[model samples]
Target: MRFANQTATFGVAALLAAQPAMADVTPQQVWDDLDAYLQSFGYEVSATESMAGDTLTVSDLSLRLAIPDANGGLSMAMEQMTFTDTGDGSVRVDLPQSIPISVDVAPEDEESMQMVIDHGLEGFSMLVSGSPGDMTYDYEATRMTLALGSLTVDGEDIPRSAARATLSAGPVDGETQVTVTGEQRHIVQTASLGELAYDIFGRDPEVDGDSENSGMFKGSMSGFAIESDSTVPMGLDTSDMPALLEAGFSVSGRMSYDASESQFSGTEDGKATTGESSSEGGSFEFALSPDGVRYATSAQALNISMTTPEFPFPLSAEMDEMGLSFSAPLSKSDEPQDFSLGLTLAGFTTSDMIWNIFDPGQVLPRDPATIALDLTGKATPYIDFLDPEQVETLEGGDTKPGELNALTLENLQVKAVGAEITGSGAFTFDNSDLETFDGMPAPSGAIDLTVAGANGLIDRLVEMGFIPEEQAMGTRMMMSMFGVPGSEPDTMTSKIEVRENGQVFANGQRIK
Candidate 1:
C-alpha cells in the first residue's frame, strides 16, 4: 500500500508538471520546463518531442521512479500529449484518452507484487494562460475513470475475477495557479465534481467459486469540491520529509461534499451480512508544515442500518452532527508548543430494537445522547519526530520524548438518559517534580463541575436493575462528600483542586 501511494504521488506530480503555460511561451520551452520539474523529484523522464506548425507533440512519454528502502520501483507511460499555440496568448493542451500505469513493489524479505492500472478521460479540455514562471490552467472534463487492469504476485498472474476495482467521476471543472519566487513555488488549486462513485470486489482465491466467498462494496458522493494551497521549495526531494520541512514545505486543503452513501455485502462466519450508511453532508480540512499539523472533519445527518444472521432484527442508528479536530507540534523544542483537541457527537440515537436489549421496560429516558469536549494545551518535545534518525532513538524506549507543560479544558459536556454533566478546568504541570506524584508530573489547578438530574437518573438505574441499591447508596455518599447540593432538585455542583505542594482539596476542605 505504501509503494502504491508513492507511485500515485509521482504520477500526479508528473501530470501537473506537464500542464502547458501561455503568453509568448513556445512549445519547446513548455517541454523543457516539464522535464526539469520531474527531474527535480528524481524521476527518470524520457519522451519523443516533435514540432509541426504551431503544435508540439510529445509521444511515448514515460516516467520511472525507484523507491529507496523497498527494493522496488514503478513506471508510467502515456501514448501522446500535445500543446498547441492558439495565437491569442494562450495554449491549448490535448491529452490522450487513455493512460496505462505499472507498479512493481518488493518489500524486504517478502514476496514481490505488481499492479497494472488504466486511466480514461472523456470530453476533456484545458487552456493555459500566463507565463512559464507564473501560470494559470483551466480544465474541465465530462467524465473520468480509473480501473485496475491486472495484478501479479511472485511473478504469477492472479485471476482477474479474484480482485476488481474501479472509480469514476463526472462533470469536473478546476483551475490551478502556480507562481515561482526565488527558491519557492506557490500553488493554488480549486476543483469541483458533480458526482463521484466507486466499486470494489474481492474473492478468496483459495475458496471454491461460491457467492458466499465473495464480498463487494459500492459508494457514491455528490456535489464534491476541494480547495488547496501549497508552498514547495524548488528542486526539492520528495523523500526525506525532515529535509523537506527544513526547506520550508507546507500545504493546507479543504474538501467538502453535499451528500454521500455506501453499501457493503459479505458472508461472515458462513452467515450473510449487509450494511448501508448515508450522510447529508460533510467536510474535511488538513494542513501540514514544519511547525505542526492540523486536521478537522465534520458530518451531518448521518444514518446507518445493518442486518446479520446472528441478529434476529435489523439494527439502525442516527446522528444529527459529528465533528473532531486535532492539532499538535512535531518539531523538537525546549519551550512549550501549542496544541488543541475537540470532539462532538450530538443527537445520537439508536433504534428501539437495540434499546430493548438493555432497557426492555424502557425505564430509562430514550432521549438522544450528546457528548462534547474542547481542550487546549502546551507541551515540549525533546526530538523531532519527522527526523528518521531521531525517531529511531526515541523508539528505543530509553528516552522521554516530551513533557506536558499546561492544559486547559475549555468545555466538556455529556447529556443523556435524563441527566447531564458539564465541567471546565485548567492545570499547569511541574515536570521538574515527578517524584511528588510518583513518577508522574505534579499538577496544580482547579476544576468546577455541575450535574443535573443525577438523583433521578440513579433511581431509574436502580429500578431497572442496572445497579443494586447498595451501589446507589455508596455513589450518593461519595457525591455528598465532594459536591454541594444545588438549588434545583437532583442537581449538584463541585470544585476539585490540586495545590502546588501536591495537596488535594474539595471546595474549601483539604483531602490530601
Candidate 2:
C-alpha cells in the first residue's frame, strides 16, 4: 500500500515539474499551478500563501480526494510548507509539521454505521533542494501515529475507544527526475522509508448492541523498512500501453520486513477470545520490471492458539519457518521468457493436547512437514496483458489469453502424513488446437510420480478409525487399477501421459 502511494506522489511531482520554471514566477504561483494540476486528476487542494522576502510559505495545505459512490473522503494536511529560492536555479522546500488527518464515511442510506480514522505525526519536517527538472528531499519525524477517532450512525456520534500506535520511522529520503517534452513528461523516481516499528491496540468499543460482550485486539512489530524506484511516462494514458511499449520503463522495489519481535492477543467477555495469533519475525521482498515481476517472502517462529466454548481444549500449533517465492514475465513478445514458483515449510509441531485428541499412541512423526514445487515455462501472449483493447477482447472471448509453448518441471516433492511423494515432467503445447482440450491448450507429454509408505499410511488410518473398512477396500482397488508396485515395500508408482492423438494414458494403458 505504501508503494502505491509513492507511485501517485511521483506522478504528482512530475506534473509540477512540467509546469513553467521559476525565471519570473513566484513560489506562490508554483504552488497554485500545482494545486490546479492536482484538481485535473480528482484531487482538491487547499492552502493559504504568504511571502517573506524571497521565501514563500503555504500554511495548512491539504490535499483531499473522495471515494466514488461513498459518503467519505481521505486527506493529508500539513501545518507549514515553505519554499526558498537557493539562487542556483533551484529551491529549498520545507514542511515544518503536519496536522492530524481525518477520514469519515457515512452511508447514503442514513442507517449504516461507520468508522472515523485520524493519523498524526510528531517532530515532522522535510528539507528538499531541487530545480524544475530534478529534485531531492530528506524527511524526519520523531513518531507517526493513528487511531479510531469515533463511530457515527445517522449523523449521531457514539461512545468509542481505540489504542494508539507506537510507530516510528527514523527518516526518509527520495529523489525525482522529470523530462519535459512539448506537453508531456517522463519521470524517474526513488524513495526509502527507514526502519519502522509499530505496536497497535484496538480497545473494546462502547456499543449499544453488545455492551456485555466485547473484545480487544493488540499487535506489534519492529525493524521493518521499504525502498522503491520507478520510471514511467507522465501525463499519458497507460491503459492503451502505447507509452509503456515505446519507453519500456517499469517500477521496481525492495523491502525488508524482518521484524525483530512481533505478537498479538485478544480477549472477549472476560474470557480468552476465539481469535489469537503471533509470530516472532518475518521478511518479504518484491520487484517489478519490464521483463518480469518477482516476490520472495518468509516468516519464522510462528504460532496460533484458539478455542471455543464447545471444545474441550484450545487448538495450538507452531512452525519454525515458512517461505515462498515466485517469478513471471510481465510482457508478451516473440521470444520466450522464464517463470517459476516454490514454497517450503519446516519444523511443524502441535500441542500435546491436540495430539492426544487424535494420535494418542503417537503414530505420526513429530518432525517437520514440507511441500515444494519448481517449474519453468515459456509463454507467447496472443494478446498484450497491459493493453486495454486487447484485454477487453480476451475478456469478451474474442481471443485466447495467451499461448503456452513449453513447460518443464524442475522439482516436485512432498513429505507429510507418514509418506513422501516426488515427481517431474516436461511438455509442449498445441495452441492452434485449443478446442481439442475444451478451450484449453492441448499438450503431449508424460509425467511420473511415486509415493513411499502409502500402504503403511493407509493401514494406520484404518487402525485409527479414520477410514472405514469399505472405504479402505475401495481406495485399494482404485490404486491397483492406476498404480504399479515399486521395489520399495509399501511403495507405488504411476505414469501419466497425454498422447498426440488427444488421448490420456495411465500405467501404460489408455484411459481416455
Candidate 3:
C-alpha cells in the first residue's frame, strides 16, 4: 500500500509541475520542480533519469520517507517509469507492473524486525492537462492487487501467512487551483471503488517456540462499492490560528453501498461460533468547515443473524429503514451560531424469537419514531484551541469565559410510542449580574409545550398494571391545575416561564 501511495504521489507531482503557461515546457523541467517540491516536504527522491525526444524516462525510482525518531526510514522503489509530454499542454505518466516496498522499525535494537510488501497493478496510467492556474488529472486502474511478501524476526521468516486483496477503481479525477497569488491552494479530488473484494486466511500465527496457537477467524465482504469526493486546504500553516480561520476549508462526500454479504466464523476455547450480516444498500453524506459541520446517514435495510450451540434460538434483528442528521457550529463569535439535530427510524421491527419474550401482545406502537432539536447559543472561549499556551490555560479554572449572551431552543420534537411532544423557546442571559442566580447568570423566557395522547397513554399504563390507580388519580389531580386542555382529544398544553427576579410560573399562574 505504501508503495502504491508513493508511486501515485510522484506520478501526480511530476504531471502537476509540468503544467506551464504554454505548451512549450520541457519534461526535464517538470522533474526538476518535482524533486524540489518533494525535498521541501522532507522526502529523499532519486531516480535514473534519461530523455528521448519528447519523453523522459525515470527508471529505478526510489523514495525514502521521513519519520521523527527512527535511525532507518521506510523506502520503496519501482523498476521503471516514464513521463511523456504530449506537446499540447498535456503530460502522460506510465508506470511499471509491480513496485516493492519495505519497512524497518526499532532499528536501534540488534535484532530488529522488518516487513516487505509488493503491489501489482494492470493498466495503471494517468493523464494531466489544463491551464497554469488550474490543473486536472485523471487516472485509472483496471485491476489492483497487493501481497505481503514476508515478515522476518531476527532475519528469519515466521509462520508463512496467506493473505491478499484485489481492488478496482475505474478512474479517479483530481483538480487543483492556485489562488491568493499562489499563497493558498485549493484541491478537489474524487475516486471510487467497484466490485471490490478481499479475503484472508491465517492459521495459528506462531504463538510460542513450539507453536501452540489459540484461535482462528476468517471473513470476507463482497458486492459493495465506495465513492468519495473531498475538498480541503493543503500546505497551510495550521499553527497560525488567524490564517487557519481565514482559510475555512471544507470537505463533502457520499458513499452508496449496494447489496452486500459478509460472514465470519471463529473458534475460541474449543468452541466455534458463526455470525452473518447483510445489507440491502445505504447512503451516507458528511461535510465539515471552519464554521460548522454536518452529517447525514440512511440505510435501506440491514440484518444481523447469528447461530450458536450456546444459544437456544437463532438471534436475529433487522430494521427496514433508518435515518439521522446532525449539524454543529465550530466558530466562536459574539452572535450565537445555530445548531440542529434530527433522527428517524421507520419499520424497525424485530424477529419473533426476540420480541415474543419482551412484548408478545405488542403493547408498544410499532410505528416509526422521530426526534429533533434545534438550539442557538454563543460560546466565549478564553483561549485559542490551536495555541499551546492557551490550551494549557484551559487546565485551570473555567475552560471558557463565564459569559453567555443568549440561548434559544428554536425547536424540540419527539414522536414515538403513540405520543407526540413539541416545544420551542428563547432566552437571554444577564451576564452583568450572576449573583442573582447563585453564581449563575439569570435567564428570563417562556417555553410553550404541547403533548398529544397524554391522557390515553396514562389510561393504557394504568390498565397494563404499570401505574397504580391511586398514583394515576394523583397525577390527574396535579395536571388539572397546571395543564390546559387543548381542542384535540387527550391533548394538553402548558406555558412555563421564568422571571429575572427568580420567579417561576406555569399557565400564567405563579409556581415559585
Candidate 4:
C-alpha cells in the first residue's frame, strides 16, 4: 500500500517537472503551452478558463494519463489556478493551497487498489519571464508537503489509523531556464532547500481483536541542493522511456546534502526491534544518454546502531568514508566503449562487543578496516540494451549481446585486523579461441601485488582455532611457492601473468 502511493507520487512529480514552459508566453500562451505539453505525453487534459482584464482564471483543471504496462492509470485534479499578466512582460502563477492526486493501480493477477494523495503548499510564489526562443521561471515557497489522504482496496476503504505517510520540505527556492531550438528543448534547473523530512507508519488491521504487525519510519536531511541539465525532444512520449531515449532525450544531475539521520522501529510476532543511522554529508551524481549511463555516490562519517529482542547487546558500526560509482554503455557499438567501476569503504570499525565474541584475548590488532577497488574496461555491445526488442532477442539466447575486449585494474586495496594487500593489473581478451579457456574469453595480462603481515595474521587465526595448524602449514607452503620475500619482515611480493597461449605463471615460475 505504501509502496503503491510512493510510486504514484514520484511518477506525477517527474511528469510535472518534465513539462517545458515555452517562450514568448502570455497568460493564455503559457496555459496553452502547458496543455500541449501534457497532450504530447498522451495525457487527457481538461480545464475551464475565464478572463478578466489582465488575469486568467483556470478552474476545475484535471489530467489523466494511462500507466504503461499496467491495467489502470493515474488521475489528478485541482480546484483552481490563476495566471496574471504583470504588464512588465512577465506573468505570475497562483496555485491552489491544496492539490489532490489519485491513482488506480491494477497489477496483473492481483486486486486493484486506489490511492489518494494531497499536495500542500504554504506561501508559494512563481514568476515567468523572457522571449520567443528562451524563457526563465523563478519560484519559492515557505513550506511544501505531500501526505496520503486515503486508500481503497477491492472497493473497501481502509481505516486511516492503519496507514499514514507524509513528506515535507521548507524554505525552498529554485530557478529554471528553458531554451528551444529547432526540435529540442534545453532545460537547466537549480534548487535548494533548508530541510526535508518524512514520516511513515503502518499497522496491520486487528484480526481477532489483536494486531500482529506494525512499523514506523522517520528521517530528515538538511541543506539539500540540486542542479540538473536536460535535453528533450519536442513532442516525445515520456511514457515510452526507450522511445524517448531514442528520440535524443538526455539528462545529467547532481545533488548534495549537509547532514541526514533516520530511525525505524517495528514489532512482529511479539518481537520488538529498533534501528537508527546518521551521516555527516553525502552527494550523488547521475547521467543518462543514448550512448550510456553513469551513477556515483559518496558519504562521510556514517554511524549506525541497532537493537533487537533476539540480541542481548546493541550492535553498532562506524565509518569515516564510503563511496560507489559505475558507468557503462547502453547503445550498440562495433568499436569498444569505455566503462568503469569503483568502490571504497575507508576507516570502518565496529563495537568491541562484536570483536570480543571472536577475539576474546585480543590476539590481533583492532585496527580500522578498509577496502577499495577501481576498475576500467572496454567492451563492444552488439545490441542496444535499452531497446525492448533487442533485449528480447538477447534473452532468447540466440546470439551473444556483447564481447569484453579489455580491462584494467587501476587500483585495489584491502586491509583488516593485522594484514593488508594491494595490487594493480591490466588485461586484454581474445574472443577467437574460447575453447582454450573452456568456453571463456582468453586473457593476456600481468598483475603485481604486495602483501604484509599475512604470516602473523595466520598465526593469530590458528591460535584462535579459526584455522587448523595443518591447514596453516599448507597455506604457508602455497604462499612460498607463488611469492618471493619482500624487503620488510613478513612481507611478500608477486607478479602473476597469463599468456596469450593460455600459459600462467607466478613470480616467473610456470604454474600452468
Candidate 5:
C-alpha cells in the first residue's frame, strides 16, 4: 500500500514524507545527487546550492530532445527546456522550446500537419526521489488533449490537470519498475464536436472502494459514465444547424496499460448517432508512445432512422473497420513502420456517407453519391533522421551538429474509397544548410506508389466537381486518375501511379 493511494487515479493528493535517504545526506548532497541524475538524462546543470541546511536550489538547468520530421526524419537539433526546483520535492520545469524554434514538428517533411503550430509545454509536476528506481512524475495535459474546444485536450479548457506517478525504486532486488495513473476534468462547450472524450464517456457502472482512494493513482477503478451530445464546429459558409444533423456523435469504453509504452484501448462500442439518427455502437483501441509512435484500430455497427430535423433517408452502416498505425520520429538509424487504414461501407444503406463525400464541402457543389469502399494503401516518409537544428537542441553542449546519425523507412500502404497504393523512402537533415554547410537543397527525399481502384471513382469525381463530366466518359482518363470515385458501380477497374516527381500516369501515359 505504500504507493497504493497515488496508483488509484488522476488528481491523487499525496506527498511523499521526508525520504530516509536524506538522513545521512545534507541538502547540498541532495542537490548534487539530483543534478547528477538529470545529467544522465541529457540535462545541463550549472549549480547546486544548499540553503539554511534543508533548502536547496539548482539553477541553470536545461534539457534537449529530438523530434521527428514528416518523413520520419530526425532534426539535426534537440528540443530545449529549463527547470527550477524548490528542493521541497516540488519542481517547475520551463516549457520545451526551440532555438529559432520553427513551431513545426518535422518542419521540412510532414504534409498533414498543415496548421504546423507547435513547440511548448502543456504542464507537469513530479515528486523528486533517488534510489534510482523510486520516482514519480505526473503530466495531465500535454498537448494531446486539446482536440476539444476547451482550448486543450478533451475540449476541456483549464490549466493542465495533474497526474501523480511513481516507480518501485527501493525494492530488495533494486527493481526499476514505474507506474502512473491520472485524469483531468475539463468543461466543454456542446457546440464543438471535439468537446467530448472517452474520459467523459462511459462509467464502469459501479465503483466501490475506499472513498479516499477514488481517483487516486495506482488504485483500481470501476463504474464510470461518459455521455455527451454535441455538434461539430461549423466552418465558413456552412450552416451551423447542418452539423447537428451531419456530424459524428459517439460514445466508447476505455482501458489503459502502462509498461514500456502508454497504451489505450477503447471500443467504438458506443454510437455514432449521425444527424437525427444515432448508431447502435462503435469501438476503437490504441497504444501511443511518449516519443510519438502510435497503433490503433476501430469498428462500428450503425443503424439509424430519422425524419424531423434533417437527412433525406433512414440509414444503416451495418459493418465497417478502420485501422491506423504510425511509429514516432526515427533516429538516424531506426527502421520505419507503415501507417495505413481500411474502411468498408457495406449495406451502404445510409445516404449520409454518400452525402458526406459528394458534398464534403458541406457548403458547395451539393451532389448525389452512392458507392462502396473496398480499398487499401500505405504511407511512410522519404526520410527519417535529425536535421541540424534538432541535433543542436538534443546535444545540449555535450555533442555537436557534426555527430553521425541514420534513418530508414521500409514500406507503408493503405486501402479505401476504392484504391490500393504503396511506397517507401528516406532522407537526412544535417547541420549544414547546404548553402553554408555543404551545398544542397535541405537533404530532399521522395516516395513512389502504384495504385489501382474501382472504376466508380470517375463519375463520382465529375459529380463532386473533381473532374469534368467529359473526363469521366473516357476510359483512358479513369485509368490515369489517382483513384476512381465510388458513385458508378459499373466502372470498377483503373490503374494509377503517383510519385514524388509530381505526375499522374496510367500505362506509362501522363494524365495530370
Candidate 6:
C-alpha cells in the first residue's frame, strides 16, 4: 500500500521528468491512488475523472489552493482545471489559458508592496507518456496579461505599472508540451508583470561518442529580452523558478567532445539596452586540443551610440573584431601545470570614444587608428609522477616533487595609444634556483619591436598636444643622431630590439 501511494503521488513529477515506467507502475494503481494524493493536499475533489477508451478525464475541479506555488498563497477564485490520465501509463492537466492577478493596495500600503502579477497562465496540458527516462508533459498557450502598482521594500515609488507575460515550450519526443504565462490586468502599479521564464532545446545527436567520458555541446541565441524593472528581488523563494532559456530568447549552437579533445561554437544577437542606441551583434567560437583551448570573438556593426552617466554624451563605433586564444595543460595538483597564449585584432577601430574600452578608468589615451597584434607563449609544469620523491601516493592525478619551474616565452606586440611596435621575449625560468620561493623558479624572456613609421607619427602627436614643442625639437635631435623607433632617427627604418635586461636600441643604435 505504501509503495502504491508513493508511486501514485510521484506520477505528476515523474510525468514532468518523464521517468521510466518499465519497472513497477500501472494505470489502475494511478487512478486508485491519484485522488487520494490530491485529497491529501486538501483539494476538494468535485468530480472523479471520467474515462474515454484508455484515457481518464477529471474536469470541473476548483483549485482552492495549490501548494502555494512560489511566492506563497493562491489568489484566483473559480479558475477551472482538467486532468486526463491515459490508461497507457500517461497523465495530462489543462490549466487556465490566461491568469491575471490584481493587487488592491491602499496608498499607504503601496510603499510596503513591492510588485504585483497581472496576466498569467491561460491554459496548458501536460502528458505523462513514454518509459521512465523519456516520460514528459507538454504545455502550450497564446499571450498572457499582468498589471502592477508602485511600492518600495526600502522606500521608493515605482515608475511603471502593470506587466504581462506568457511562455511555451516544445514537442518533447512527440510526447509532451509545456507553456506558462503571467500578466497584469487591472492593477495600477509599476511592478505588474509577475514570475516569468521561457526555454527551448534540441537533441545534440552528434555528441554520439567521440571523446572519452566527456561529451561536446554547442548552442546559439538570436536574442532574448529580460524586463523586470519594478519587480522586487525578495519575492523569489519557490524551487520551481521557471528556466533561463524558457524566457523570451532565441538561439542555436553546437558542440562535441572526445576523451582528449572538445569544441564549442555559437553566436548571439539582440537588444542589449533600450532607447535610440539599443542594438546588438556578436559571435564567439572555441575549440580544445592536446595543445589546449583556442577561441575567437567579434562584435560587428554594434551601436556605440549609448549615453550613460559616465559618458554623458552619445558614443558610437564598430568593434570590427577582437579576440584572444590561449591553452593550459591540465593541473597536476591544486596548482596549474602548463600554459600557452595568443591574441589578435582586425578592423577594430573606435570613433568618438569618450572612454577607453581596455581601461575603463580613462587612464590611457584613446586611439582613432587601426590596431593589430600577434603573440604566443607557454609554461611548463613542476610535478613529475615519473619521479616518486613527491609523496607516498597521489589522489586525483600526480603530485609535484620538490618545486617546479615555468619555461616560458612572454612574447607580444602592440598598436596601442601613442605607440605601434612588436617584440618577442621570455620571462619565465625553467629549472633555475629552486630554494628561494618554495619550489617555483623565476621567469625570464626577451622582446624585440619595430616602429615602422616614426616621423609622421611623432609629428602628428606633437600637433595633437601629446608631445610638447621643446620635446618635439629634442626628439628631432635624437632622431638625427640615432634612428627613429624602427630605423635611424633621420632615415625611416624597420625594427627595434628591446632586450629583456632593459636595453632599447633601433637599427643597431642603442637608445637606452
Instruction: Order the numbered candidates by lDDT, best leading.
Output: 1, 4, 2, 3, 6, 5
Error of 2 at 45 (Å): 3.8
- Best candidate per TM-score, number? 1
lDDT of 2 by residue, 1-512 (tens): 22333355333422222222333334555455455445533467888888999789988788876653356765667777677655554455555333455555666765755554455545554433344334343444565544556666666665544434445454444444443444443444544445565555554455323333444445455555555555544454443344554565456665555445444455555544565566666767776666777898888888878776557788888878788988877566677677778786777777888777788988766556677787878887655565566677875666866678889887788887778899998888887787888977899998888988777788888888899989988999888888899998888999989987799999899989
Q: Who is ahead in lDDT, 3 or 6?
A: 3
lDDT against true structure, model 1: 0.82
Clashes of 1: 0
Q: Candidate 3, after superposition: displacement of residue 410 in Å?
A: 4.7
Question: Compared with the true structure, what per-residue lDDT tens digits does model 6 show for residues 9-98?
Answer: 222222231233443323433434434433433433454456666455555543323332123222332244444554445555554554
The TM-scores, one per candidate, come to 0.94, 0.74, 0.73, 0.93, 0.29, 0.41
**Better structure of 1 and 4 per TM-score:** 1
The predicted structure with the larger lDDT, 1 or 3, is 1
- As a TM-score, model 4 comes out at 0.93
lDDT of 4 at 124: 79
Q: 5 or 6: which has the higher TM-score?
A: 6
Lowest lDDT 10-residue stretch of candidate 1: 13-22
Of 1 and 2, which scores higher on TM-score? 1
Candidate 4 stretches with Cα past 4 Å from truth are 1-25, 40-42, 206-211
Candidate 3 local accuracy as lDDT?
Answer: 0.60
Question: Model 5 Cα RMSD, Å?
Answer: 19.8
The segments of candidate 1 whose C-alpha lies over 4 angstroms from its true place after superposition are 1-23, 209-212
Please write out the lDDT profile of model 4 over residues 1-512, one tens digit for every residue. 12222332432332222123343467886566556555545678889999999999999999887775667877889887888887777778888888887889888888889999898878878777776456676777898888999998889887888889999987878777667788877767788866999999887766313335889999999998878887767776665556677888788889899999999998886577899999999999988887788999999999999999878999999999999999999888889999999999999999999989889899989999999999999999998787777888976788799999999999999999989999999999999979878999999999999999999999999999999999999999999998999999999999999999999999999999
Give all candidates' CA lDDT scores.
0.82, 0.63, 0.60, 0.82, 0.31, 0.37
Which candidate model has the greater TM-score, 1 or 5?
Answer: 1
RMSD of 2: 5.8
Model 6 misplaced stretches (Cα beyond 4 Å): 1-130, 135-151, 155-275, 278-280, 283-298, 306-314, 322-332, 335-413, 416-419, 422-441, 448-450, 463-465, 469-512
